[model samples]
Target: MTPDLVLYGYWRSSAAYRVRIALNLKGLAYESQPVHLVRDGGEQHGADYRALNPQELVPCLVDGGQVFTQSMAIIEYLDETRPTPPLLPADPAGRARVRALSQLVACDVHPLGNLRVLQHLVTQFHAEDAAKGVWSRHWIGEGFRALEAMLAGNVATGRFCHGDTPSMADACLAPQVYNAVRWKLPLDDFPTIQRIYAACQALEAFQQAAPEAQSDAPAAS
Candidate 1:
């Protein structure tokens, strides 16, 4: 069957993972087109994919004539277009809190540990692969420390990041937690994050969006 929606992404890309989770949560049917970030010198940089996204980023959503870039924007678009379940809160304060939690990881933590940045650290700065892993771990740990405090300290936090239901924050967070797991970053001190990760993973949406379940994921994951 021809897909109603299409997503371009690499298997393990955190940003792509976020979009997949959001699409799943919204019960939106979509097709996955893998853009191997490491193979053939990065398929996202190719002319064809570049035509779709000049930034060469993953998780570009194409629905008919419309094309959406950036994971957060696409997820928000989904939330706006499909309001049955509603990812954001109706209240302005609640929406702001959800967005802040989402940005805390997506902006503050993810940038320091993104794949391209890690590759650049090795290629440009002459850092070893181990050093690159350390860099990722360090930033993730720092961000989780703050996230832990925020989630644990706030009364607004519930089963998920914002409230009982999954929000944009949970969609943003689950992917970063996957990255942390891959890097073997310690989460002993961040019990709140650990609990949330466990809860999110239990859901079908998060499960189907996981890298191991993706069609393009490498064998023996």
Candidate 2:
């Protein structure tokens, strides 16, 4: 049976972006419910959305009768349930490596530049746009540097992060690099990551999952 799948996400969210890539890669058809994270003091903080996700986070996936929060968890759930065009590799070691790469962006780089953290910087610490960009670029660059080394040095890296086909790591990497480019961070030094990103973006799945292609995407953005 095909379960009803609805993704509640903000168009610009890196977490949500990763999930979008995952859904496309798995050839899953799902409805997108846009959560405007920055409109009118954030829709995610509203009573209804918060009730749906106590964490008040974007990128919650409602699958059939189950409500799932967190992008990585939702992605893994999709992989486990669907099983074709697998997001994780077949072997345990390969899966671990992919997961490690995924976490490099999702867990480490992303959190430091999360919407709330950026909002807090402005509201609590009075950080300007320049400062926020600096904060975002710093972590993104540092993380990408390590990721570049991992990919450039490893024989495991193929057309994608793991092999020729896109995996969870590619899903995670595509969005973070998108954010990096948005922030005007240089990708010249990370040639391997840049090359991988270009390859991922060229695919129809990734192109369709792009932020600009979302219904909730801004009129001018």
Local error of candidate 2 at residue 77 (angstroms): 0.4
lDDT of 2: 0.93
The collision pairs in model 1 are none
Predicted candidate 2 versus true structure: per-residue lDDT over 1-221, tens digit per residue: 45398999988999999999999988888989999988898999999999889999989999886899999999999999999999999999999999999999899999999989998999999999999999999999999999999999999999999999999999999999999999999888999999999999999889999999999998899
Evaluated at residue 80, the lDDT of candidate 1 is 88
lDDT of 1: 0.91
Please report, as a residue range, the 10-residue window in candidate 1 with the lowest summed lDDT: 1-10
RMSD of 1: 1.0
